[model samples]
Target: MSDEKNDKDRRGIQSVEVGGQLLRALAHHGHPMALKDLARAAGMAPAKAHPYLVSFGKLGLIEQDPASGRYGLGPLALQLGLIALQQTDPVRIATPMIAELAQRLGLTIGIAVWGTRGPTFVRLEESPAAIHVNMRHGTVASLTDTASGRLFGAYRPADEVRALFEQERLLGKLERPRLAPGTPAAPAPTSWKEFERALAEVRRHGMSRTEGAVVDGISAMSAPVFDHAGAMVLAVTAIGPSGALDTQWDGPVAQALRECADRITQRLGGRPPVPVRRAA
Candidate 1:
């Protein structure tokens, strides 16, 4: 009985949904479309689609070209898109997801966005068994060595990342790594060549991982969240005590992190980029 009621609650107007398919097709194609092509893309007969287009045009949701008879999104659609973009907050949309993931995976989950300096944590959900780390909402992660930072380094503009790295280096921040007392000595400061390789690995796998790089005993994996323009708008990261977190690229934790990021991207009406491929 509950399931049936839920199903009924989830139902929406069928005609509205059908009409939306035309809008979706136009958006997907990203240009004006002929009546026949639009109807075929929307999987409706042209006659059936014509009435919907006429109604949409009347409402300012679509426009038809007088010279070519092509259909395109109208002023109302552009206004709606702009409004949606303004209200789309990746951190707010991702908070609940990361909270649930933190509970399920028994690790810490965080959302980071491009801050004034670099990738800065805006939301953090620490698990019950959380490790003793000194991270908070405003903590700016290291771009060269940390999983969260490397994610931005991988997907963000090259000049921007290079500037940040150069600044950190000049400040002596990247000269030496800080490691936990019992953790083995931190690896050498990353050279440009090494940094490029690290980011390439991240792009190839669609995520980034670091073990004992940021903190001696903590391991983390991060995935990028993109906006409608395919821009890397956020980075979702999961961290925990090193051995306990399963930091392997193909491990369950990494998979969960990527899935969570993908959900956030979809929520924003965004799409994740295809993984980078190496030349044969």
Candidate 2:
């Protein structure tokens, strides 16, 4: 059996491995690269890398910008990544980490994934103290009123995020009259400008937080988890009564949440998006 395994390992192609290394280098850099740089990173000569890139471009695994002569992952690569993400259970992978976080912090932890209705809580680990907030598995968090939702809003595609905000607006209107006559309306972003500003902050810091926005006296912080293709797959959130779970982005709870999300992202072979720099 050992010899058969060794035979199988030794039976493969070298050129294919070299081509895959180029793809891996492009993926690791997470940006388009000039031919020379890409070849250097892959430890190959530009002359040698060009043919493989041409083949990959024909197959839709890579694309070269005509203007800049830079190479990046192509649409087919994105499609393959989405398909691969579908096969993995993000919630299952996040469960143990969330459980450990809950136990250590004495705060409820939840994993929310992008569902048809937006960011939906798929799993929850309750804190030892019975904190009474209405979150449960399958609860569709309000995109404009919760940390988990805003985390998704900040990281998800713009079209999807806009749709979620529109849906939330309609729902809010429908549910407004149900509130007690004098109850104060929830404070939410009132304009696209405000919403974009909030999302910008989330993007800059790689997390989001809310204080009493979803549930009175409740606080929550959430960080995004990415897949191998740099797509957001889920979010890890920490929630508790306001006094227990600090809502500040730099607090211990927020740091732990971000670290847990980062760990999950790394485990899934994902890279965070590279920040763009403007002219000085």
Candidate 3:
């Protein structure tokens, strides 16, 4: 089966049993790196590691920073991330909560599990209010583009996350994080300070917002969801164009998102995932 093959390929690339070691190093380094740094920190020769990094990049599973040449996990890495979370009906478990969130906040809501390409909008619950702009089901948005992606992308592991930084060009890629016209461009977080600041806000607030991070006048925010076995960022999401919610309720909606995702973790019958420390 293709699934089995992707798994095998993934194991060969990551050696997941020991992959955490490489990820930890990336977290500490806190900047884009040249290939030399990846192997040194990963405890392997750059020559031996070069092929894998290149392979990962070719797969869009990882990328070399054009600005700095460091390799980090790509969007494909997030696609690979769901291997653990899909063990249960993660979407179903999050359903009632997401719907309640929709009803209460009067904004379209959903949960996006992280993947190599970015956050896949796996579920959507629209507000009953006739005024809502409809968001589609099964929409996949990039971590660089949407609130769902940011909530999840900002939380991805560093070794696996570096590739998620803004890419310079897309001449030979399998996918592109969906970009809407007129959205302000985000310079890839090229340093730990910037990456850490984003992650810190996500943690402290349990989410982040954009006036139009993805689309002009379209606002969104999200939280994180964990599965029982420590699959982090299982799903946390919210979205709407400007002026959808009562200004006062945005805070409560955010809290509800965090609370509901946490409760869903328990409902799904697994121990909550440990927070992977934000990369440097």
Candidate with best TM-score: 1
lDDT for 170 (candidate 2)? 65
> What is the number of backbone collisions in each predicted candidate, taken in the order shown?
0, 0, 14
Write model 1 residue lDDT over 21-74, tens digit each, in one string: 999999999999999999999999999999999999999999999999999999
**Candidate 1: stretches off by over 4 Å:** 1-14, 29-31, 40-43, 66-68, 174-188, 272-280
Q: Deviation in angstroms for 119 in model 2?
A: 0.9
TM-score of 1: 0.82
lDDT of 2 by residue, 1-280 (tens): 9999999989879899999878999988999999999999999999999999999999999999999999999989989888776777777889999999999999989999988888888899999888866556888777877788888988887777887787677667312211125555576558665787888888988999988775567788999999876888898988888888887778889889888999988878787865543111
Which ranges of candidate 2 are over 4 A from the true structure? 1-87, 173-185, 274-280
Highest lDDT against the true fold, candidate: 1
Q: Give every collision pair in model 1.
A: none
CA lDDT scores, all candidates in order:
0.85, 0.83, 0.62
Task: Give the runs in model 3 whose Cα sits over 4 Å from its true position.
Answer: 1-87, 130-134, 166-193, 246-250, 270-280
The window of 10 residues in a row where model 2 has the poorest summed lDDT is 173-182
Error of 2 at 51 (Å): 26
